[model samples]
Target: MDQAREDWSPHSAHWGAFSARWNGATLDIRPYEEDPAPSSILQNFTTAMRHKARILRPMVRKAWLDRSARSERTFDQKFVACPWDEVLDLLANELSRIRTEYGAAAVYGGSYGWSSAGRFHHAQSQVHRFLNMAFGGYVRSVNSYSAGASAVILPHVLGGYEDVSRRNVTWDQVAEHTDTVLAFGGMALKNSDVASGGISRHIERDAMQKAARRGAVFYGIAPLRDDLPEEAGARWLPIRVGTDVALMLALAHTLLVENLWDSAFVARYCTGFDIFERYLLGRDDNTPKDAAWAAGITGIPAATIVDLARRLPRGRTLITVSHSLQRAQYGEQPVWMGAVLAAMLGQIGLPGGGYNYALGALGHTGRRFNAVPIPTLSQGKNGTSEFIPVARVADMLLNPGESFEYNGRSMRYPDIKLVYWAGGNPFHHHQDINRLRRAFNVPQTIVVHESAWTPMAKFADIVLPATMTLERDDIGAAGTDPRLIAMRRAMDPVGEARDDFDIFAALSRRLGVEQAFTEGRDTRQWLAHLYEPTRKALAEAGCDAPDFEEFWERGELALPSAPDDGGFLRAFRNDPLNNKLPTPSGKIEIYSKAIAGFGYDDCPPHPAWLPSTEPPDARRPLMLIANQPATRLHSQLDFGAYSQSKKIAGREPVRLNPVDAARRGIADGDIVRLFNDRGACLAAAAITDDVMPGVVQLSTGAWYDPEPGAAEHPLCVHGNPNVLTRDIGTSRIAQGCCGQVTVVECEKYTGALPAIHAFDPPEQD
Candidate 1:
């Protein structure tokens, strides 16, 4: 399949590359033949383009249309359809008024860049560029909800986030030389189903199978049995939730007591090991972090811990940490301590042996880097500097002007009057859905560009219908993927829906900055401009560099990949002084002095075990694991056939251990209600021993459908785990999201079931 058929057009998605064709009745999708493992998420494309939930035209809330006051905002309001010209005029006027009355800082340009795989029509770049170049600067956000803790802490401890995680070790190296893989948080394949940009092929499953066939042992240190794929045949440890640091500390203590640690490597390649040694030996805490001490906390036997520690061969072990570990309270410690353990083993730079943060977390990781550059749309320079951590959206809206700390800087939340969001749904990603709903009610003007009737679109004062990926033509490229695809348009735009770029271009014209925003280029011309850099780089690298037209005709171009050897870490290990790390000490910091100067009690100078704030309460005994969903990407196209097929009784499934289910008299397919202090949600019970006792696994990404009521804590009928998750930060320093683990209690539902309207369109006036 060198080239797609005449009727089919090539395209790419976050999941993988595919060819699609419209036959007047159905849209046919064919996965790329090169992809060894295609994601079932591709099933979302069959009925998604013309789903009933698609937003047909520009809509304005009736209450906001009557009066643009915050008091007029409510979830029960009706939407009034208006012409594109009228809605654009209203949008331009509101933006101008907000900028003149308050400042450009009062406008928050929000986008998460997941709307499309096409670089030219990327919603984030379009919105940010329009705001920055046309409307002056706007307030922005920093960091993501997934790797917030590690993204802040890694630069201080080792290196940049990508350097340590994506570019450090290769899966090919693991298949060749690794002996033991200690997965702190089990590397589930579901987490690797989709990458941020587009991925041509998924290799985690094949790589893990190869490594297992080479006689490498894998240890899954999580409560779920299926966290590690079936091909790996990993032994499950089933540790207690949020107690990973205790077990890691015990491993280090055992290495110290038995003299198995590499002393020379620690002294030369690492800093502050002696200071950390005192704490490991109980000189400062007098508790002696031994196997027995960790056994009580993690529920693993002391003998098992000791034997596992002894089995790890120095210079032959790879320590992999999943993103799940650093998405909880005191999340930074587990990531930091995993690096410390790898440093102790003296395997930071060896082939197939080292610390790979978030190795199996996404599809793009653990793969070789591209030899040539990829296409990227340049977002013009921002105008304002005021920003907050991405997970602090609720706090920023609720407490404007309140001071907060992040990394090392202290800043205040901006007094935002207008929120322009595109490409993302905060209702799905943000914690405590009820709190986020209140935050959405605070702003004077809320505008959004949506393709479907998500909760974000329903809450917006103005909703502009945006086009789906299949309705637009652009170029698709990813940083790690080797394929550069020409995303040809497969279908016409539905109703009055427009591309985000065209929508922003229209607004730019209304604001009298169309020249600067558009650069005299339409969507097709912009795609060519964005692809030029990649073409030049490929030509320079001696690869085939076809022009945009030729490449478009060919459908896809193959990019060369770099060697599978270790990257910068290899050079740093080869020459410590010349190729030093980006950290302050130029070496791995087991104990960071700069962090100690912050004087935060929650996050100490070094990685230490901190008791969770939400301890075991008799009222809420079960620990809820709010993880990512396997059916679809975060609440996108939840009405599709693939996502809908996984539902039981028209609701998301919640996995509970047979032990916990029996105690509560729950059975498979039984509707159950999960309640905590924050909120409650109803889910279908799936009783199985795959999950451990006293734990329940309910995935996120269910469309947020709350029962209409005046109750402060309304029950979500769609089983959205974020409704019950707390909206607190991991600590003051990082301010990362700690919504992964929470305490909750579940009971079989005997009351009448509430109808779910999450996928339905809102009422139109």
Candidate 2:
């Protein structure tokens, strides 16, 4: 759709004409670089972005535009549309007031889906910078869009985000080098920011195929899909969703019992292997579960488990882990265990041997992990009171008397009275969406910055209209890719919206701390200051040919190189100390010394498996796995031409297996009520054999619309799944899964739905 149509001089654009195009109507297009963007002001932020330009090679033009465009956008004709001035003023005042009243800590930053093409000007950095500027300091976020599970798991596992994204393996080499590609989450193919980087893999895939034809084995361990081809012998393991940790435990037990583990590698590159092995053997009965036991639950034959476990690409085994497991109870554990499984295979520093979040995040910088020391922003940072690991949000909220130790101190829950949020819709996150609504009601003031009526926005005491990249400029620095691009404007403010950076920058100005946001010349000057570290690197290679200055003129900037890549790997191996992991032990923590101080010895130093949410009521049968659809990012698919594409053949329906359907007397296309003890939702059911017998699946992204009689709309539930499906208990306290595992039964709908149903018909013209 034409998002702009400004009357600029013909000479404005590098292209011949600035003639506007159209989606449904001609949008105002301008000479994108006129306005100066500013710093972001969300209390704390972790959002990640899309794009078109000469920066991309022509070999993938359409794919690049399709992948990157609309990293930032607006909800069309929904909610109250306001003029820019009113919107900006109201939005800014509300945010400023909220921060003053509640303190920056009360605010949460969020933006799950990716939006920008240029790596730097994307969500997390831009949003966080804005939030940090406005509120002094907001809670910092960790993890990338993909391996969020690993993010939570690895901090304790490999150490931190800097460690994981910093891995040296080019995982695509797996399909070519490994004899067996044991995988999980076949249901998820694309990485969260997969297409945004302009990396396509058909050519690479062909190479993988040639390697596969020469006798490579690929096993996709996930809930659905026999979709893997026969040539690759891609066997789909039917481990029930939320039960993955159990399966991993079983596999680990088998590997240990059969002595399939690489004992030599265990000693050389990893620590705590001896301790993990002892725990798995269950010298303690706390581990009531084992491989033979896991076999019964996972439904894969015990022999197959043994075979796959033993055959997992022995010297060159490539274990690919998925981020989805973290969406369930014990979310962090599985990814932890998955990484351990790879380490046990002894493949970390080897070619074609390692754990892949996916193929493309291979940082191209060719930078070394370090012969160099990391810079510390703080000297002796104390007094940032301890908190629970981020994955344990539910525990922080609902677990009675639950407390966690952080930074050498045990802390009780603070009486959080206010919530000031910018850049995120919590409805798409945390969990038990309905439960959260009531939880949110506890806050005295809820302030949010938004461009649309996001589910999280509905609960706000004040809604601020935030900019959509077009209204203001941003100097973004994405951690995912090694690029630092400028976000120049393409259109004027659509309505009351102003860029988040401007809102925060101006708010800081009002609060009498101009220097807080000041480096402090102007947005343009700030960009130059931010790029100071990379200038020499970019200059030396001529890769900075289109230097940031030139790139900024065109609404983008390219970086010189990444901090680590393939070459970095070989060089680091030659000198392990210079390339060693950034862990306390400076080696893979088959056993983390950090946890010994924390007192959770039962939890292995390496990845140890635990059961899914325990106390599973035998009466409540099937597992509910919330999966992502490629069509949309989180709950963001609404309000664009993209909306029309999400419908399966036109409309989406909750999918369940036929057997599970028959038991409940549910039929196809039936508007049935799906309810559990927590809450209820009425959705159309499409029973399919594609799903596991004991599992049901729903694709998230529908704009949550609440029932009409709802005393008040739960902005989080405008189609919010959480309203009816939230946790009564913080089951997956640390491993994630705050959203999955609700037991709901189906019933025919008796109530009337609005013109647009909570689950609407597939959007179309």
Candidate 3:
């Protein structure tokens, strides 16, 4: 056994808190001692920081440098190394020109954060603040690609996302009180391995294990069997893909017909129940959403649906819907129906007996909030109101001035000429990589701040090298996480990379707004300033508020956590009249009239099961589940050793049922081609029964390695499911991304294999 190194420097990642030290040759990463089920994602940090994929210096696209037309912009263009000062000057001039000629609305400030756990160095905040202060604001994006559908639908039904998921029904409550957990989209532990802010402990497995030991039962209702943790001793109900709404409706209908639904609670605390009931009982449609009906659609036995419905009301039940459910066509239905089913059971406000959205989707959720304030970097308000949904970036870029409906509002996409992105990668998040590639060529200038030569950087006209988390100091804290980790500098900046703050501040100086952007503070000063709010709150609460210097030496601090009191939902359940929800009706909207007014045929007023748009065709019979990767966080460090270790033949692995694999003559370890109308990708086949027949599980976040000179739906050498995914929105109302599920077929690849060059740097001039 190795001795506990004394020189380990503490740091934080979205996965968990850890300490690292260079053991002469390689980095030694250790999880926080308190974490019971530490994540293997921390191993990625050991090799990713100084990987060859790291962007060494500022670069400009050769075509852009040669003054080629915007259509010539592409990922294959050579990147010419440019000095930071010269590139910054060029970017500053471009910003001024774009603002003067096309106005600030034409300059889209694109960033999705997730770059660092440190609040001050957060890419989204840094980019938005820089644009707001230095560039006089830019067109922004609303909602996230991950939870776009739920973020919009939750407010109209129950309340805000934070009110329902973050502050209500914590893991502690689930462990102690929950008897039955009906996970519509099974709470996969891999999905919960990360949190938006840093997470101190990985508690989901421990909590589920505790619940299972106490006679609690969990049912994983998804196409994949392992969505639930093994410790939960969960029963798997392999429902058909994209039919969660139908199953939920059947459960509700059983409750109604059997007289098990709490009519008194529904009448008192909920609105629009009668309207929804008519549809459920088939009063208007003459088709009752019964168990038999759902059995046909969901591929689950009718008896199982009735049994589950009966058992739900027998004990304290927690109905959970994962974020994956809402990343499909008409994605809003499953989310709305999950809340309605919980409402029917009338267990919504009880401890561990309510509706939790995306409960195990992230680490910070299903946990109590912090009792004190945490460090926050203020992103100044946008000067312009023109914006689009996060998933609609491709649409906005390609269809400028095209009107679209979102949440009952009609808005047009702004004509973006200059795109300034920092921190996050749009190429990894957006669906239909081929369509996104075309959209990327629309903008006159695309600038990015990146730490690696990711596909997004390759597609950009200007690439500014940025520092990785290990290279800089930051304060790591999440609202629900108790630990405040001092993310100390583990090493100097790799290559000529600069901190996002430094890069933005330098640009601000070039743009003559340095004072406003930096607030006359350096990185250390900003950290101290950001820490003051939390420290002052701690002092006022009579808690230990260590000075910045003392805190830095201590490495981490444990903050107080709020008791699980069920948040706003509990308050509303206790007193509906006084403590009401933020909805227009001020109660649970079982069938929202506001949504009905929108008149979207796809998304009706009630939670109706609309047939999926991406139906299985003869050519593409198998359904592809483009879900989150278990190895990495959305392609952030795909070149790292841990991620590389999981790759099959240097390409991402795709799991298929033995039945499907045999039909295609695709045996285990066989390199297969998965294709659809949109595009194609090669993946190594992993034959397993975990995935149901007619369904293949291919995780997203393989660096999109398209074959050279194959434009317009080119084949990706690396397994990137987004290449075959649809680019359409969920529906007219929410306009969320429908990237989760797509139809595709696979066959053994008989052609010569293309070398995997996704991790390699682009051609340099």
Candidate 4:
């Protein structure tokens, strides 16, 4: 039997597919991956065991007794573990049935987070590849919240695949070279990926202390703390979130009005200058409203706004955190406006003068790998469009939508009877958590593929076990490093578990398309097929990494990176027009001709603000947002002890301003219910001045903790923040997710609410 499918002996999470639910059925199990001629088996054993111990370490000191209070997937919970064969058969049958009734379009593919860092065994990569090979394919949406804004708006702004390109200058240029920085969101080196890992505020304080000793001046404009070093002596011009464009436009108008504009640089490079000046800068009778008008919207004093704009230094200037623009009703405007502000100074396209997404640029400095393209294979007639871009789930699921075109087919998701989820955990990433749980309940079925159980998997009809990165053979680039580390199966399965690749490959075979995938080949043989292109590339590069097998056994192979250049400043300058940007016009599209072609008038040609979904309502006065945790990435493997150990004690805390909390009669450490029209989160309040007033922020990625009797375990009921976030505003600029806006009202946390268990098979119910 193929190694990929041979692991499905008997007892496995896959059994849920067979009987609608696992009902205590059992079967034969085997050592999924047996290593022969074990070289350094002990070395590998210790490494793997250490990680395994680390993952389970929390369990030793774990207070499962109380974790049980919020726990959805407890051993004591009445569950019926069943056989893998039955589960696989049922899933195959149901999938086939769904396809027959609704077509391939009836299926939805959902993914979140990199399940494992391993290259080959990544749940997302395999899932996408398999989905394409199975059903024609589903609409796909990918990215994290921290960078989603960049991924979405940059292409529209830069007029290309925004991920390409490198900075012509470095951070040193921003520090030593630039004069005035129109800091957008004010997130500095610490919160950003620029520091490699995030920098600590204490470390940031030291950098600021050093820069301040030199007597530098910084005018910080952000809704939150300006990440400027204190030693540089910073002035905070705290602006309202999402009102950045208005302030920027006002500043641009001021610059143009005072005749302070850079005429020379404007003449050197930049097209459409006249139109921008006329419409945005406001000349003649249109005498644009000055900084005061912007101040009203942004909450910065008009005089202060003007003074800061005028005070900018003469040399290269930078605009950081342009993502603030996306926080409002009209999100793109601020980003575009920031660029317009740079253009007004004739500073853009100059060294350290413009804006770049924090790590937005992907510079492949080396010669492009010249590997031949893999033959385009059909995703065997699997199933159809029951799949919407999971980012659009709030749009497709919550609100009934008029049929929309997807994957060349027009469809709606109302008929979606079963949802097969793998790879991503929408619970952690989506906005408006409380609302998502309800919307999720509306679906007839929800199944998840997981190694360590998560909220999504708990609510699933079938919880398929998966292999961890350390326990599976996978391949991937080191990204920064030159070596390719082959992930070897280190530890044995905890119980009834199989690698995701094995689970899906077998499921695909049972669905009648096995030949297209494995063709009955073993896992190693199939891996060789996948690695062929990589092998060729390594050979071409004269890599001295051992033969693929030896490399696999030893587990590391370094690859070369291309050279570096001042990619930031001189990108596409040679042929801006023909520079192959993904837009209709390849150059930096100050005007998005492609979006205009798509007929999304709201998006328009320029980056403009559209009202966010969370328009202020009388019922809910506070705006809500979700932020990421430092320890975890989105919602992968939360069961590990290291992560759970990091959880805030007492209750999940919602960090809000003390002023706002005081007004609402809430206090520090006080249990609060963060309620919106969509749903409510129960957490203690951390009323600190660190957060700006009027906005409530939660570190999402908490394991869903269901109300005491929630029909679905709230733990199982991972809140889809998307419920509070609307999807219809922005066009499909790139992927489906849009910037989020939500309203919040705080109330004292009233202990466990209710438990909601999902439906069992109709027979069991």
Candidate 5:
């Protein structure tokens, strides 16, 4: 018989349609007709589906099973295969013991973002639901790695997180009305390609193309040229690292001095501007934030800075700030200052105007779609509410009783005995891998549900093999996206792997809460249950939607597009009093009194120029930027052929300026060692002027592979940038990660290179 072809969508933000050709036992995937140009993310679907690193069965760490032979070699340890019943029983017993002894607060649910895009199989929601139902509850986390700073600070400044995600002006509006788009940190095209929960239409690239065609002049204010799209005709301004806030302040100051400040707008819809103006001038501080001062700090010419500031008010403008700016020291400033600058331009609610925290950072930004909230597995109210900032996993593990300030509240870290992780990988997201590894050893028991033998899985006490999205039936709909795609099971589960729902259901049965967990429904029944609401929503919107059975058979449903509203902030701008923001002032808080009440010295009331905490030692003058990878989604398919093809000499590629390369006697393709006070990593040098001098670009998400016990500088064989990144928080107020605050010295490696073992499985005794 001919192979059965089934339509399905993978778990990504740039949701491309695909046809899975199933030949009895195996599956072959190809892009559907709708996906005009399949990206590298689409090409690697098969490789991710059939990688060698996939975990086949339940694995128990030998050291944990045999108490007598405990070794410190966590990464090098062997795993012994165990049956599903035994593993489930062991997990249930341990969880019960922990609850009985240490209480439910001792169990930490360590699931981050980057799981299956399917609404049904969302790993974080599923795990939380299971824990909430079976056990009392688990300590959870807030915010995400992408925009942790904005998640906390934006609420004080612009009312809520929606100002960044839902309220930002659409690209279509920009193309139609805006004349200039100044992208600070630039439009990260690669980062925007993939999103969580699956993308129905990958129109970000096309959106940029349209905007460019409509005569919107794009200017990239970043250290690298490749940060912006080549097709957008972006004029690059190689700004110095960690100096964006200084540049923004100078622009604001210039606007004030040149009589270009929107006094009427500020007087009507802003607060604490007088105090900010004093600081911008030389009244509060001895030094003025003038064009000259900004030029010295940002490396951009004074003329350029003044010209840009003046030009912004002449036409419809949008200041696009990437999330990376806030992943550094004083991370909140850039986000805050970007808004202040936009407010000063008096175009906060105008079409193609205002500040965008993440314009093209993800797939769903600024898309005109219906506001239907996708239903997720209900995580019942927790008996105990103990949580930490998302990026502080290592801190929580290491410091049990330590108190830290977060969003104007003092939060104490709970002593966690059991860590139940599913879906997300903390090893990839958390900084300072070596420190995190040490912290990982503190938990009494660590359980992980993973498809592949990632670093997180290898370190777990019990590793439960979970099926990938391809091997499961699911429904995918991104936030506010009109299209709903069916994720049909392409093939049977690999080996003894199971879906998260099945695994959690079986565990719930052992825990005596099986009915509560499953709600008297199997996988198929649950999928149909979830689809009913969506069908109802489509019908209400006057769009034809098939029944559950018909929808399952058809495989995809595209809802009619919603009418394009002017700008996301149009309602608020039209009537400030009636459609008031949820903030205390009911207007834009340029200087947040709420934040000031927190008394955080690092993060002040207003955006201020604070030098980064990099060592001033001349030997380590270069600033290392650990950016997002272009090949794969945060260590997801690093072993795939598409991702592997980007590897230079079996190591991550590090981009360096020609001047820096010449100064260090390093050439393109040369094996280089990047070192600082924290740790060392290896990478193949790519000599180019794409990066500014005294700066280097090493994309993060490389699987961390450290040499066993070389104390002085344990070699990171796989070029993971986390080896050198700081694990400190952005500020005492926000308490987000300062992952980008890294300074390192790079030189050509002249020693024998260590074999890359991060991709390979551990040896079995």
Candidate 6:
């Protein structure tokens, strides 16, 4: 018979379709007709699927079985393969024992955002549902790494998190109405290239092009010039790291002093301006937040700051603050200050004239689409109500029963004995690898459901082989994307690997909860059940969509278009009192009284400048910034061909200014050691003026590979920047991660470079 051709979409924000050419057992993927030229991220899907690092069979760590073995030596231990039935039985028994010995609250479900895009097979949901059914419950995590601070703080300032995600002005509105776009952290093109579920079209680049064509000025205030596209004609403003809040305060001061602020709008629509004004004009503090004061802190010219402040209220201006700013100490200030600046401009509800916390961070920033909710596996209820911040995994593991403040609530970490991780890799996401490694050894047992042998897999007591997206049938739809694409099983599962749904279901059967877990529906039936709602919504909107059988065969269901709304906050702007927000005052809280009552000096009532944590030595003054890699989604495809191509000297590339490099006697392609009090890491230096003099950029997501005997200051052989980053909360109020705070000194490495072993799987004895 002729080879079967099927359509599929990979998990990404710039999601594209592909045609699978399968000849019985072998499969090949090509770009579909709709997306002729697929994105780089999409093109590497097959390479990742067929990579050597793929976990082909279920394995168990020898240390976990041997009572005498040390858990700290997990990296050196070998794995042995086991049958599915045997592994499931072992997992079920251990789970039951843990519950009986301690409690269901002792089980920590470590699943995170980076999982299968298919709503049904989403690892977080699948694991949560199984745990809820079989066991009493599991300790869950709150918020996400993308915008953890914004997720918690935005609701108190604005109405809720939807204002940041769904209520931003669309790009078309910005193009037509806005004259100047001030991007604080710059547009992260690489990070925007992919999404969670799937993307039918990549509109970010086109939207920027459109705005540029319409004569909108783009000002990128970041260390790197390439933060925004060259085509956008963005004027690069190099400001000092962690000094954004200082600059914003200065701008507000200038506006207030020059009588450029919207006093009428402030009186009518905002609260707490008097308190903020007192601080701004030196009434509270003897030091006025003037242009000169900001210049001293931000390293920007006083005249330029004054000029920008004057120009902001001239035309329709939009101020965008990247989530990266809030990943530092006192992180909430910049986000709050950005809003205060926008409110001063009298553009909170105007089309293209407000503060956008995450504009181009994701590709679907301000796009309009049908509000079709994807059906998720029902996680009935948590019998045990215990949780922690997502970034507090290490803290929870290390210091159980420790009290911490988050969003005006005091919570204590549960004493966890078993860690059941499904999708996410904490080794890549968490800060301070050495601390996390220590915490990893504290748990009695660690279970991981992974497709590849990630660093987390190496540390696992039981490693369950799971199928990749390409090896399973799934349904995908990103939040802002209008198309629902079918993800067909292009090839058979590699070795004995199975889908997460099957693994959870089989485990559920072993635990005597199969019916509860599966709800009497197999994978195919589940997919059909999930699609029914979308099918009905499409039909009601006068859009043609086939049934499950035909949709699976054809491979996509596009939602019907609706007339564009003016902007996200248009309705609120049109009518304020009647359409009041969820806030206490029903107006923007420039100075939140509730937050003031929280009594967190770290986060004041209004935006204010707070110094970042200082380094031990003032001489070693470079601030190291660990950003997201352009080539991979976190650490998902670090082993892929495309991601590997970006590596410098077979190591993670660190960008530094030429002046700084010359001062340190570092040349391009030279191996450099970035070290501080926390930890150290080795990276290949790439000398360029793209970064500021006092700042160095090393993208995160490199797998953590520590040197064997280097315990004092454990050196990460693989260029994982988290090894050198500080693990602290943004503030007492939000308690988000301060992953961006690190001061380091870089020097040329003279020692022999270690071979990168992060990509290789552990030996099987």
* Candidate 1, 1-765: lDDT as tens digits: 012234888998888899898766557889999999999888888778888899999999888888834354555679999999999999999988998899889988998888888888889988999899765788898888899999999998999999899997887888888989999888889888788668888888888899999898889999888899998879899999999999999998998899988888889899999889888888977999999999999999999998888888543899998889889988999999999998989988999897999989988778888888777777889878888999898999999999988887788999989999999999889999889988888889999999999888988999999999998898888878889999999888889999998898899998899999999999888888888888999899888999989998999999999887688889889999998999989999999998988888888888899989897689999999999889988888888889999999999999999999999999899999999889999999999899999999999889988898787888998899999888988888889998888999999999999998987888999
Error of 5 at 575 (Å): 0.5
lDDT (10s digit) by residue, model 2, range 31-71? 22421211111100111111110011001111112324412
- All models: lDDT? 0.89, 0.50, 0.90, 0.50, 0.82, 0.81
**Pairs with backbone N, CA or C atoms under 3 Å apart (clashes), candidate 5:** 13-195, 15-199, 117-197
lDDT digits (tens) for residues 1-765 of candidate 3: 123335888999988899998654457898999998888988998778778898999999988877744346666778899998999999999888887898889999888889888888899999999999976778988888898999999999999988887888899988999999999889999999999778888999999999999999999989999999899999999988999999999999999999999898899988999898899999998999999999999899999999989998999999999999999999999999999999988999999998999899999789989999899999998889888998999999999999999999999999999999897777778899888988988999999999999998998989999998978999999999998999997777778999999999998998899999999999999999999999888888888899999999999988998878899999999999999999989999998899989988988888897998668889889999999999988888998889989989998999999999888888899999999889999999999999999999999999998898856778899999999899888998888999999999899999999998898898998
Off by over 4 Å in 5: 1-15, 22-27, 68-73, 566-568, 710-713
Cα lDDT for residue 596, candidate 5: 83
Tell me which residue pairs clash in candidate 3. none
358-407: candidate 4 lDDT, tens digit per residue:
42111111112222222111234433434454455756656555566432
Evaluate model 4: give its lDDT. 0.50
Question: Considering TM-score, which of the candidate structures 2 and 5 is the better prediction for this target?
Answer: 5
lDDT-wise, the better of 4 and 6 is 6
**What would the TM-scores of all predictions be?**
0.98, 0.76, 0.98, 0.75, 0.97, 0.96
lDDT of 5 by residue, 319-435 (tens): 888888999878989999999999999988888887777888876677776645454656776777999998888999999999998988898999998899998777778888889
RMSD of each: 2.2, 9.9, 2.0, 9.9, 2.1, 2.3
Model 1, TM vs. native: 0.98
Candidate 1 Cα errors over 4 Å, as ranges: 1-6, 68-72
* Per-candidate count of clashing residue pairs (backbone under 3 Å): 0, 49, 0, 67, 3, 4
